[model samples]
Target: MEPAEMTSLRAALAESDFAKPPRINLRGEPIPDGLTTAVVYQGHEVVTDGSKPLRGLDRVIGGS
Candidate 1:
């Protein structure tokens, strides 16, 4: 994919809401500090535990 296309894909994906990932507590549970934390995006629990971003907005949304 072209550089521009790739960039767009990442943005959309980043904005998407998702379900709770592994080792996550959504019941007002408190998580320890710096304990191999997971990445939370738009109320979505990303199991990848990474906030580096996955895909661009357009591509992630299956547009271009």
Candidate 2:
């Protein structure tokens, strides 16, 4: 994800009541999951300026 997207997400997570680091699965792999509604930017669909983006490695380019 881009830095700007991340910055916005951080702000929203900070305001949330249940924001927390994700836990790992039994195989020692971190489960990918997030909570938050998101709004897609008009010019860039991949770009979201939503209150919550539920960001993770899965959302980042090359992170896959």
Candidate 3:
């Protein structure tokens, strides 16, 4: 994705309340707070954590 698109997406996520931190785990159970292994991005190279449940928005806009 283009840098401009990434910036726009990041801004939109910041404005939306539904946008929460991402989670990274192999288990089916949810991960606890402050234990994120890394800041994963939904589409491109944005910073996201695993603080909230996964949603459609968490998925990449286009093919990754």
Tens digits of per-residue lDDT for model 2 on 17-62?
2223232213233335723333233222232222323345224422
lDDT per residue as tens, model 3, 1-64: 6998788777655544333433332344555654433333444333334444445444433212
Report the Cα RMSD per candidate.
Answer: 9.5, 13.1, 8.3
Most accurate candidate by TM-score = 1
Better model by TM-score: candidate 1 vs candidate 2: 1
Instruction: Estimate TM-scores for all models.
Output: 0.31, 0.28, 0.30
Ranking by lDDT: 1, 3, 2
The models' CA-based lDDT, in order, is 0.44, 0.36, 0.44
Compare candidates 2 and 3 on TM-score and give the better one.
3
Q: Quickly count the clashes in candidate 2.
A: 0
Candidate 3 overall lDDT versus native:
0.44
Poorly placed runs, candidate 2 (over 4 Å) = 19-64
How much is 29 displaced in model 3, in angstroms?
24
Error of 3 at 44 (Å): 16
